[model samples]
Target: MTNVELKEKIIEYSKEIGIDKIGFASADPFLTLKDRLLEQQRLQYQSGFEEKDIDKRVTPKKLLPEAKTIIAIALAYPSKMKNEPKNKKGERRGRFCRASWGEDYHRVLQNRLEKLEDYIMSLVPEAACKSMVDTGELSDRAVAERAGIGWSGKNCAIITPEFGSYVYLGEMITTLSLPPDTPITDQCGTCNKCVEACPTDALVQGGQLNSNKCIAYLTQTKDFLPKQYRKQIGNRLYGCDTCQQVCPENKGRDIHSNEEFEPDPDIVKPLLIPILQLSNREFRENYGPLAGSWRGKKPIQRNAIIALGNYKEESAIEVLEDLLLHDPRPIIRGSAAWALGQINTERSALSLYRAKETEKDSDIVKEINEALDYITSEVRYAK
Candidate 1:
């Protein structure tokens, strides 16, 4: 069959296999993306989670030799959870971002990509193909934008007209030549809501991001969160959605096309106090299937502690104290110290004092001392 015929067949099969949207693009190097990446490196704005080799990331041929076209696919996920759990005062909750609401998108997208790859191989036995999801060397958003699947938004998310920005993107590089789609026009004309709404000013400008300051990147980190951004993190346990939430284009857009992406409210927004008690095995068994759990239980638990601090939940003081005094992980212990300070009651102050006396880790000791200082200042002010 001719390449055009094969492309048509692929598109039809994609819809059959539950791919929400598919677009085709040439496999040429992403020249514009390279310049932005270099700028990000020079500014030290990267989150350090990306592929180190810039050449490999921008050049599709480096990933799949003689690649002629990229087939980009987008699957819409639910933005709103049904039967969402309420965040009561005592039973405070931490939230996983909309992207992490469901089963790991990596697995869902990979399954679709594999099905598409097998179908392509069936048609052209000699054809070569390489598929990648979020973790791939090639940027999923860049490829999707190039393939006309969506316009890259100021929030740094690809915003599909149909699904808004609530879509998981994946792409396949193939030796088969196909007609490429036209790029989408930029729709974020004068609206600066996402940039302004960014709690940390991570969005330096439209289409630019300082990942180091991005809460989404910060949440995945396994260390004690930087003091400055801790309050800005609020109740987010996994990722930040402030930018997307404020975007006008994303208004009233909550697609639930894929059942696999539906969230379990209890899991995605769990009680802050109980999260502090989850053992590693229990955490894995409960949350391993979710995308937010990829960084392991440490970051999530640490963020949960921070969330409790943000809420100033009096009931969480006991659990936070236990973590501060007995948790083996320094990050957890230090975060608990900060949370106790936020609670700022006499009981919490006592816990900080107790931990301060026994805490030998210099870093954790500093956290405890700072907590004590904060409590002292608050108490003096009240008096």
Candidate 2:
């Protein structure tokens, strides 16, 4: 069959296998993907890698020597959820981000793309296939925009009129030169809400995101959190969704999905008490499939503690007390101690003072002492 026929077959099978939208782009490759990645890295914005990798991703044939066209797919996720039930008080907003609320999307898209490849190779038998979803340098958003799937919103996400920006992107690069879809025009005219709403000022002028200032990046990233950003983090434990949450264009598109994208009811507004007591294994089991995997449990637990501290949930002092002495990771323990100090409870204050008395590690002991001082201003205990 011809490449056009292959494109048709791909669209048919991709939709059949549960992808919401499938569009074709001649692997013109990521013109901006390479440059933006390089800019991010040069500005020290990347998770890893240097300018060289970014260069390759931006250049078409350089990225995939045999790549001809790319098949990009978008999966919509639920944009809204029921607020916490009144009985379950002290609930924090989601840290999992809107896109990662359900099953691992990487796994979901891989299964479908592999099937599409199998069907194509059934006819060609010699075509090469490499599927990627946020793994490599190829820009899924750029390809999606070029493929007529959607236009890139000022929030730096591709938004389909039908689904808004609450969609996940994945692509299959192959040796077939499929007929590319028409590109969409930019619709973010005179709109700056996404930029304005960003607490960290991650979104620069236009749709460009200054990664260093991006709360979503700093939250899970290995980089040290800027002093100003901690307060803005609020209760977000995983990824930040502030921009999309306030987008005017995203008012009420395909608001939710029946797919595995549905969040665990408990996850929508987590119980902070148990979260403070979570072990490494427990943390991994609960949020492993979600976006929290990258940071492990330290960040989530730390954020949970901060949320408790912010709410001044003195009742959670018991839960925080347990974590201070029992939690394995020093970061979690330190953050928990800091939280207990914020709760203004005598029990938290005494537990912290006792933990500080015996704690020898300078980093941890210092934090515990600081917390002790903050919680009990009148009690001047010698270190």
Candidate 3:
């Protein structure tokens, strides 16, 4: 079969295998993306999760010497949960973003890419392929944009007309010389909803993102969340979708094409109190399969404490006090102290006072002192 005929076959096979969108592009160097990445690095905007080598990231040839074409594929994930659990006064919940709603997208996309690779190898024995999902060196969004899968939106998401900005992207580089498709035109004319809606102003400008301040990046971090961003993150336990949530193009766009992307209400919007008390095995067993759990239970538990603080769920004071006085991880202890301050109950003051006397970590000590000060000031003012 000719390269064109093979391409057609691949497209047909993609649909059969449940790939939502597919586009082909020549294996040319991403020069523009290289410049932007350098700028992002210079400004210290990187999230530290990206590949460190700039050359390896921008040049496809470096990844595969015989590279001649790239096949970019997008899988649409569900934006809204069907039977999402409710958050009440004492039974507050924290959320994992839409991307982490179901099974990890990396596994789902890789499975499709492997199937595609097997099909192509059968057609052309000489074909060589390298497939990458989100964690790979090459940027998935850049590959998708070049391959005409979608236009890169101001929110830093590849916005497909059919799926809006709610799609998971992955790509494969191959030695076969296939015809490339035309890229989509930028349709975000005069629309600034995403930029404005950013809780941390992570989208400094259209098509540019400062990942350090991004709530999505912030939520995944293992360290104690900075004071200013604690309120901004609200109840988000894993990722942030404010920018995409507010976009004009994404309005009313919710796809449920893939069953794997469907969310379990109890897992995605889990109760905050039980998460605080989850043992390692219990955490892994309950959340290990979801994408949000990749960073482990600490960050999620920390965010859960902060969510309780954000909600001022007074009912959580007892558990927060126990965590402040006893949790081994300083991040949990410190965040628990902060949450106690937010709750401002009479018992919370005594917990902070006792924690302050014994806390060895300077950071945790500082948080405890701040909590005590907040409580003291509130009491004095109320009198």
lDDT scores for all predictions? 0.93, 0.74, 0.93
Clashing pairs in 3: none
Ranking of candidates on TM-score, top first:
1, 3, 2
| Per-candidate TM-score against the hidden true structure | 0.99, 0.87, 0.98
Tens-digit lDDT track of model 1 for 245-273: 89888889988878899999999999888
- What local lDDT does model 1 show for residue 96? 93
Candidate 2's C-alpha runs over 4 A off are 49-52, 82-84, 87-95, 222-227, 369-383
After superposition, the stretches of candidate 3 with alpha carbons farther than 4 Å from their true spots are none
For model 2, how does the per-residue alpha-carbon lDDT over 1-383 read when each residue is reduced to its tens digit?
67677678778777778888988888765666666666666666554422346555665567568988888888888876665334234544335677667788778777777888888899788888888877666677877888889998889899897888888898878888788898889888998899888897778776677776777776675432443576687777677888988887788754565467777867745776777666678878887877556667667767777777767777777777777777666776777777777776778788888778666667778778877777667454423
TM-score, cand. 3 vs. native = 0.98
The alpha-carbon lDDT assigned to residue 267 of candidate 3 equals 95
Per-residue C-alpha lDDT of model 3 across residues 192-232, encoded as one tens digit per residue: 99999999989999999999999999999999999999999
